[model samples]
Target chain A: MTGNVRLTQVARRWDAIIIGSGAGGGVVAWSLAFQGMEVLVIERGHHVPFSPPDRDHLRNHRLTQYGHNVGPSLDDRRGMTTGDDPTSATWHSPLEWQYNNNAMGVGGGTSVYGAQAWRFKPEDFRMASIYGVPEGSSLADWPISYADLEPHYIEMERELGVAGGRGGTQTWPMPPTAPTVKGQRLAAAAGRLGWDTQAVPLAVNSVPYNDRPACVNCQHCVGFACPVDAKNGSQNTFLPRAMETGNVTLITDAQVVHIESAGEKVTGVRVVQRGKSMVIPTDRVIVAAGAIETARLLLVSQIGNQNDQVGRNLQGHYYASAAGITPESVYDGVGPGPSVATTRWSHGNDGIIGGGMLADDFVLLPIIYAKRALPPHAPTWGDEWKNFVRDNYRRTLQVMGPIQDIPSPTSRVLVSPTETDAVGMPRVVLSGTAHPESVRAQTFLLGKAKQWLAEAGAEQIWGSPSGQYLSAGQHQAGTCRMGEDPRTSVVDPSGKIHGYANIWVADTSVHVTNGGFNPFLTAMATAIRTSSLIS
Target chain B: MPIDAHLVPILRAATARIVPTDDLPGAAELRATEFILGFPEYADSYNAGLAKLPADFDLSTPDAQDSALSQLSSDDPHFFDLLRRQTIEAVLAQPSALWDAMGFVVTA
Candidate 1:
């Protein structure tokens, strides 16, 4: 890679240009590069290593500023003109959004994710076929099914070194490490409730597999970078491997402005690198900027919008935390990620209509824990508040329910009419309401959390505010949904864009619905599947 | 072991709360108080807020102590908030064996 290869000069032409070096783009780039294709990956964020992990609690105050972070505002789209417009969706930092949804960086959201690699249950792909669409919902079956993607899931797990137990009712492919004290407590409590609890299958190393160190059980795993190279992210996994192949060229801090297309075919992409705008032509352009950003980019580029489905069908895994203060500090210095999981709440039974996982909530850092201790009745300031923070920071144990939100046409990313980002691109305008069923599902899960916490000997407990404006959990999905009909979907079953033969989308944006679990594994699996086809 | 005079009171208070004198190897003996007080100033958000302190101001003086403490207590709720939070986190990050002997988490 040349130090000064100008984007304008590169506009001459290339074999492939993959936009966004996150889950999907990174995988596709690696596959294509290994196939001897000249590939260029343009990422808007800076490239930084996870060395000297930022464990300082104060630095982790806000969710959005967690890692090497950059992205367009959600309000930059056409539908929402001003922040005052009641219809406009509020935008938060993409990094911050990951705490609820996905993380971003050179590795994309995979950098800070819990790396709970679970294959989409066969039911997840055929949701509409199995459950039938409920009234007033856009629920539909995935263009492809679990059987079609199962091999790719295995490939990604092996490549990424996913660790967990295999084939219970859930079909976790890897076995888990022994439970920590907190995990044991959660298991005991869950058993008393007759709920199915198991050690969470994680992507972190268990016993020095793949030359990465085994997890030290630092209890700071979820949102913080692993000090040891145990947690598998693209930077430590695919991207490095791709680079070693000497075929992939990664250009960080190059924000793609738009995809220039002639009629049905994409000609090239316009990007801003080092404050200069230039166009880089390529034979094929893959949009994997993530669900929210990818949709916003397509909308901005005027690609895949003939049917107006590019930025439409947005979905996020909505989450709520139910917490309580126990007499003992169950928040003992255990590993940070959820150590145990309950799939009991994952599937609806006996006339129930929604599902979610009740997992050990361990994402809390010092600042967030202190802030959460402030109850509705507690004063925002003063000695009483200080004391409350001091006492409850260690005593609190929370259960986070990441429930699925039904897809809606109204839930979308459009360009805000008035707001422009640093590069003059229109900000993403998010619209939509929290699906009522989602709110109900979250409430049900909160009750389950209360039960667990109470059984674990909590003296006081509280539920999260209901129907809070759901933030983009970086688990954003369904923007460029995959469907058999080109008129209704942006990409085909093979992840190839309908009109452009060479172009493809391998991100979560192709998802028809956000699954009940975290979307990272699915995203990785989808990327692997797309790469197999593209190869 | 003698405690650092500058951090004696703060350490005394922290250890008193974390593991009282009646409990095994309280914060002072574990050097947890020193660990907390001597935590790199760079990691403290409070230091960032005080970046513009007057050139002539002597941080060691009694008046400066009162002024600094008052400012931290009044204008910066986030500072005290972080202080208490980090102190507890430090205590928790210590070896589980220490906390186990103190009867926090029972070990088999």
Candidate 2:
């Protein structure tokens, strides 16, 4: 039976109620459900159909001009203020870049993501201990180390059917997919620079795993749904498995409005389903909404902020990208273009604070390439622009990395004092920029990317500098950080919210320091560890 | 709002100016006007923007049309930018002769 149940049909009380159904919440739901507990997972958006998938070139997640594939829609609005200037506040739709949204559907970002499942290095867990705290930053070491989550990472990788090179006990269940011509070329260049390259770990299938088909190597791999259902996400893996246990109920298009609490204990959650509001009772409440919304939910409920630590220290990866024109045609129109990566710059770079891993970018659709990968002096339109695109479409290559940003407490999400969304809910106001050390780290990574491209026999190289804008977007994390002290953090090492027994956070919201690579795998591993400790 | 039938030619001419024909097919050859009309919001914006073009824009020379577009870009940047972006998107969306010439393969 489909777990998509109507509110009237579900039980009045659930053993555990999980908010949001992305990487974090999905894992928690599966963990708790397999333990014979009734789990209710509420998502704010509906399930997007896999068949007749959205193929609009202009409106897909890659380029949201008209709109995005998965949506909070234009009805959702956020107030954006830059650098502590309330007067600079401007309202933007989720379609706009300033809104910095992940997908809003039942699978959340996992539904439309590229499925890059990277594990953070051991140094990532000890950012403060390894590099010392940068001035004017809120950088801290995670209470739980990498060794604590290593076993969970291996388990989640197998569950998600990840494909990568084999290692010791942390081996991938599936072999890495064949490298594309661009990936091979970039790997050779990294070799010349005395750096080792490895196949990027991806939560996608090389052969049929968990009964899903292998990748067909289609051009439309990233930012779009897989036609073959090959890209494994929480939507296909954990959520369905949890449903099969008959203990997990999924309610889509259910917007959680408030948390009903009695002093220090969370009693239930108030949700708006199809325009009607109702409170569903639960013994335990696990908030796994993405970083921004998770904090906004607590702020609006006027709980979980006893120490005023609900929505501070917002941080996300700042990507440094460089593009160049290879001497020969490097792009062979292969799918899932990002197959090679170098972790040489991920850590231990001389004179740099925390660095990041460099990898070949995902397949670029024609429109995205034309807009983002064109030469610096190329025209935006007309015959010259069209001609340039036709000539370089097959020879252009780009390398980018997501630098580990130094978290600043000032870069935060707050309930706007004067703005509200279409539903009359308090709008979230994002303010402040990243720490200066983050920019230095990004610049260093950009230099390495350019060097890699130049070594690959490229001509006419150009790069984009990381801007001073707030860095919380697809990989957003570190809003409600976990620590032993309630005065400095929102949750404990086990993801239990401080001062509350039954309320917990199992998402990136509990991250003290998001790693230098994609954070989804880390988020899932932590989710499993957190759910295991739940009584 | 529906695009006025009389201004349809103006919309086609504007898209052509953005992606003019060289050795390969351009926006007009790829049926960009039809694709643009499929998007109701984009079509309405095109309807309003195309109505402001000079009456002889559809009959103008290639150079004259380019000049007019450059003027429109300065006069109404938002409309011109929307038209330009949509034209490129429409041309790329279809598996037209341009994709073949550029070696961009679309697969299932």
Candidate 3:
């Protein structure tokens, strides 16, 4: 185990082999190791430590190009075309797609997420119970209820050092020492508007907890590494702790190709590392690659093909924002994530047709913000535009909302026949559209944002134009949904894949419905629950 | 003291509009222009670009200020853009108390 052992050398079987190192796999590895079970964790991304002494900010930014820094230019991987018409871009070509927000590293999406850890409201788990599914919607109730996962949410909050007050005036188990000033401002604004805005419960530390340092307010938390180890990503919390157990082994840079199964049971997994492909035996296996890749992995492996539920029901949230030039400066470079949030639109009430949360804009550097500017009735370049940037670069503020997408059976991830990745795996083909309800939600939130800016004393407000092609945000969920019925679901209540006792899924893919709030907290909670069940 | 030699008056105007004078000193006293101009990330290109300016032009005067900005604006919009952008960024990058005076929270 100590040397650079190939898969051939490590032919001995293991108790468990986890396919990801994010929230789900990290939790399972820790729990199994604690139970004295041998666990081997395979992560496709590298283990990047926080603020390495010789860290080149430029190089790191390049590696993480989907973020604000100059990096490998990302092509939209969403709309892949199938036919070989000369004009059509290949379905697998990375060059054709638009913007990609998903992060690919050891911590998965959690490493660069905004860390808005919100639990799915009680109504979310029972979607069929509350709102009857409309025609053309694949909505259904989750196998497990929020009540069943409540304690696990609490456990996740405690373990991840989530800082916020609790729901409905109920006190948090561990209260934050002090709310960030941005959170305070948002709370004040929400109070004035008569909307229930709460301090966003974040999986980031306000004070040193569980051996991690307190947040230093670098104002670069979202989409960037915490120079100080305060954010509760898997790398910062679970994975390292799991390694300390001595019962768990982590193999980085190992890309799993497929599961080598005998009939129904997975005997081992075939993986490629450094130009060699080999199989490592295991008694059980878990796939936690994430919503998009998890489904792609299953389709590639040809496992769970009977029901064809593995890669269906793709869902992701769409974000819309309205910004304006205020008479005053609202740019205070402190923490980087959204600190305050309003759940007024979280339910389809108040004349709003869909669900969402209104929150302040994440902190943006001037260069980043300039690129995002879209002034009404102005050319993208020229003297007027230069003047516009000069005049309003500092005097602008934004209010944004994330609209929840209704899961659709037709929207899915399929293997692209035309293209392949660096490792020869078929490229992931993503096909989906913004749900109509989600579009309506964006419209309502944009109007609300305009009103909020006016109330905040903005001189000239500019609302985003209504559009159909709303892109995905940090919230991507519900591909391999959970349900009591095996026909419609991929996993059971405890996240074990249907028809396979030892195969499990521990990622956002298991989300039955995309919750109104950020989904990271729910992911962590699910991980904790899955671990408890395995124990 | 006279305005810092590297500080453009337009930059001063933009910074004043962003965080106007109050109990706290404005961007001028903070030496924001000097900071942006001197930072290594921009120094080489900025110096070479600014070398095109006339040797004895008094940018403090309104006409000179307009002329200099217009010329710089046309040659490289990004440079002039950075001038306005960096001023606000420098002001926002200051301590939290300064930000609070300018109607902004330290976090969010």
Candidate 4:
């Protein structure tokens, strides 16, 4: 991490070029710039302007069947493979299913994220050690321990202006939003079920912070940009801090197609800007595109492939849900939903190596509610479906979260030899599903959610069906996993690729496990910790 | 949504079966078929999937329609699932007198 170049190379020329201005890259850019180092952040998506269209229930980021609110139109598809056979299926499949979950914009996923900020438990850092690595599962321990990341986690929470503390305490920077009516009922129900239901820390402004107004209960919270600027995404937090430093230049709509590297070093990146190809030279490069894209980029670059572990061990949460017909109307219609959560099952479930935190679900948009919420095999059409929804939309409560995934080397991202992107870079091929134990844990946790909902006055309860499709989507992680051993990992504990001097990864891509909770806060914390050691 | 002139009957029958008029106003009353037909983005898939049944297959009665839907779903889960989802969505998306009838209320 040592290179003292002349100021001539620092004029809008990046000292450190970060690809993808999402949570991880955002923190990294701001951290470097705060240290007075010139940094250039490149984002492949637009700086989406928040407008009324963002409130479109059917077309927003959460429900993309009709259209996408994040700018990549339905036609803007990416190449990917299916199942475990990269050679079987081509990239012509729908992007919604195959490209893995990613929001294309300056804020990246943070723009429309539900903002569930969470820290992985101590056991999450040592999966294989706590419970021996099961055969056929590529699960292993993280190089860095949770103790090593504790300070950074707190730092990330304070910097991002999160709201929440244990048992709804207001000890943090901002008081947690009063648990929604849904939250209260769920908390009581979880308590009755003997689960530790508590307030969740959210990367949302509960009170005015940094001059942004508090949440207005905008119903379109999860997949839409905050109209009042109450949500503290990387766009509102680190991106501005980086910009205000006067040492960072954020270039949006600049898609990097290649990382030009020669003999154990990355020289610069080849980007397509405004339909023009340009090269930005830099001594340091941090690829935080995403778990999927970062792995794809590394594999495409043909560097960081010493052990061929670049795109292996791709992991994401096996998200499962349980919904109940609450006797009372729990539909508060507040913007961000399911503020109450129980981490009791996050660990110590019998015979289960991993577990997930169960929380009330987000404020379901009308269309999203129609798509989900209801029990399985509920009528898809007709009097039964319509009457059920009409009767239950207000009476429904969903409890769900991401289940920790066991990594599998076979389920991975690879360079597609045939399918190429618009820039001629070979597209990513991905396949795999959650390990059987993770699925078993999902079912176990789902029962708890069902019981909690039932205790909370739900006369009838239903569990969301589980799927075996490669679970990697929005909570995608571990593609370019971090470990002390270079043979098994792409990046080291410092996030630098093994044996590489300046090339590093700081996003969920470096996650050893996706964790029971949301992974965004951990990704930001990793960025904070990694940037502190960059120089 | 502008109704597909030729596919109107099938769409209406399908929508009726999916959300048939019961004690309440149903799919036809809500114009679910017209709305779903207007969505060209996924209408082709639905049109192609529904076209599998005989042109004159009986869809007038609930039992017959339900049987057809079950068979279609069994034969091609993706198409039937898509059809079911889209039809229900069309019914639920727009303003319907049903909300008032069902005692449904949107809260703040």
The candidate that wins on lDDT is 2
Query: Candidate 1 residues A373-481, lDDT tens each?
Result: 4456654332344355555666677777677666766666777656678787777666665556677777777777788888877778887746645335557788899
Task: State the lDDT of candidate 4 residue by residue for A97-135, as single tens digits.
Answer: 334557878878998888988888999999899888887
lDDT of 2 at A524: 96
Q: Give one digit per residue, the lDDT tens place, for model 2 in A369-442.
A: 87788888988788998888888888998999888889998988888767766555677888778899899999
lDDT for position B7 in model 1:
45
Across residues A206-324, which tens digit of lDDT does each residue of candidate 3 receive? 77788778777765566666667777888777787787888878886778988877776888998887788888899988888878778878888887767978767777776668877
Top DockQ model? 2
- Name the better of 2 and 4 by DockQ: 2
Local accuracy of candidate 3 as per-residue lDDT tens digits, B3-107: 335635444443443334445654566666665655565655555545544544433454564566568778877776666555545554444344444343434
lDDT of 3 at A96: 20
Share of native C-alpha contacts between chains A and B (below 8 angstroms) recovered by candidate 1:
0.00
Expressed as tens digits, the lDDT of each residue in B63-82 for candidate 2 is: 99999999999988999988
Looking at candidate 1, what is the lDDT of residue A501? 64
In terms of docking quality, model 1 is: incorrect
Best by TM-score: 2
Per-prediction TM-score, please? 0.78, 0.95, 0.78, 0.90
**Candidate 1 local lDDT, residue A383:** 37
The superposed Cα distance between candidate 2 and the true structure at residue B33, in angstroms, equals 3.4
